[model samples]
Target: MVEVAMSNCANARPTRCIGVRVLGVSKSIKGNPVLDTVSADFALGRVSGIRGHNGSGKTMLLRAIAGLISVDKGSIEVFGEEVGVDGSFPMGVGFMIEPLELWDEFTGLEMLTLLSSLRGKFCVDHLRSTLIRVGLDPNDTRKIKSFSLGMRQRLNLAQALMGNPRLLLLDEPTNALDEDGQETICRILRDERDRGTTIIVVSHDREQLDRIADVQYVMSDGRIREV
Candidate 1:
């Protein structure tokens, strides 16, 4: 366990060794501001947790960082490369947003194979390993359509972590998991950190975040601050 002092600490690391940087980022959706001049440095090989109320711009920030959406102003950098510099999708990132979706017709392994194929990378061994890591059976042939809510969430996370992603952006990763499953996710995240991956996780579960996060931040009304 990371054992972070969640209620009152947000560790600020030096910029030189950072993994991701959000600089003066602002976004307005149909004239309503979503992100306003937000800036922060996410350290390399560390887990940072973000907590906020609904519609607080937490998801938007992750989208921008993932290059799924562009910010109207400012920029995001991953490992020193600008996120939208070439108008191309950001590379080396894995993320799970709200309202997780999965292919109900395919088995767990099949779904992972398809998702990885879309990225032009697939390894059956790796995919199977990922499924097992998330407490799922690689040998099970049950299509995802028949899986429980918790199972789907685990598969969702497995995809995000299957590859060698330099950065990970996860939203409510433990949303539908049980107590043991939640603990499993936390341990996996810490293991990822130890493997030198930078993680930015957004969750409302303060206790959960406290266990895995090295530092924490709080967001409100399109603004973010260390806590």
Candidate 2:
């Protein structure tokens, strides 16, 4: 039987240090700029919110920091180490992108199991705790093909939280969640920050960001300014 923790999991990071630092990063596609000359610093033990109107390059910026997109200019560093064009952010960083695609044929547990196996890391108990954290039912062996949007969103979050990521890059994490689900995610993020993980949440949910973020960034037309 899978053991689901009745409460939230403990924080993985217990020490304070700088987490993510971005410097003059820029990215463009098809000669059109999405993010231009962006720079920021995400400190340890804080939940930083990135907010912008539609088409403001908020998601693009997060993806750049996560090493998902190639920067046309500038650099990104996590814990003082440079993250190059290749999608590498050391071993401790984790990221969740938009569209949260998962293998429909695989059950949630199966998906996580496969991912963990890819890294030769076995932690069934950790996987179960993460599933529980996102309000997923570990015992439900149903494949992801049958999961609702909200269920898929939760599962995406669970996968990102696997292996106790030190720097979490989230894009619209609360998009498909209900009020309770949103609250739970906020709680988890706060708990992680308290434990010394730096978080960068990109979302349009102003109310939620206001409640959880220590500071907020407003991105518009590929430019960023602290709000």
Candidate 3:
């Protein structure tokens, strides 16, 4: 169980070290500002949580960092290399956005295989291990199509662990998980941190954030401020 103080504390640390730096980042969609000159430095190997009400631009920031979306202004850097707006950064990131989608026809393992093929990197052993780590049974692949909502969440988490991504961006990772699934996620995230992966989580769950996050940012009206 996570210590009660962890939820209230604003600072915590995981064993791994991964670094992020942002400067003057801003974004506008169709003339409406979504992010305005946001800047912050994130310690590598630690979990940083982003909390905000709906429409606060948390998703945009994660997409920008993952090179999935463009920023109209400002810059993002990982480890010392600038992540240009153009998707030139190497595929060292794993991300999960809102409205998670999965094929009802494909088994969980099949989905993993498909994603690995798309990324041009396949590690079957690693993939199976990740699935197991996230509380999924490889043998259960055949039943993935029939999995419950919580099972689907575990499948998604397993996919993100592929390639041992250097950075991970997750949005409401525990939204559909049960207590056990949530605990599994926390353990996997902690293990990833031990391996030096930088994790950025966007969620409104204060209790979950307190358990895993080393720092927290609150977003409102498309602007972000550290808390």
Pick the TM-score winner: 1
lDDT by residue (44-87, candidate 1, tens digit) is: 78899999999999999999999988899998989888998778
Candidate 1 vs. true structure, TM-score? 0.92
**What C-alpha lDDT does candidate 1 achieve relative to the native structure?**
0.87
- Candidate 1 ranges beyond 4 A from true positions: 1-13
CA lDDT scores, all candidates in order: 0.87, 0.82, 0.81
lDDT of 2 by residue, 1-227 (tens): 00121122133342124577778988889989998898887766578999999989998887777777678899888777777635565567767878766999999999999988876575899899899988998989899999988899899999889988878989999888899889889999988876777789999889989989988999999999898
Better of 1 and 3 by lDDT: 1
Comparison by lDDT, 2 against 3, better one: 2
Q: List the candidate 2 regions with Cα displacement exceeding 4 Å.
A: 1-17, 85-87
lDDT assessment of candidate 3: 0.81
In what order do the candidates fall by TM-score, top score first?
A: 1, 2, 3
Worst 10 residues of 3 by lDDT: 1-10
Model 2 clashing-pair count: 0
TM-score of each: 0.92, 0.89, 0.87
Worst 10 residues of 2 by lDDT: 1-10
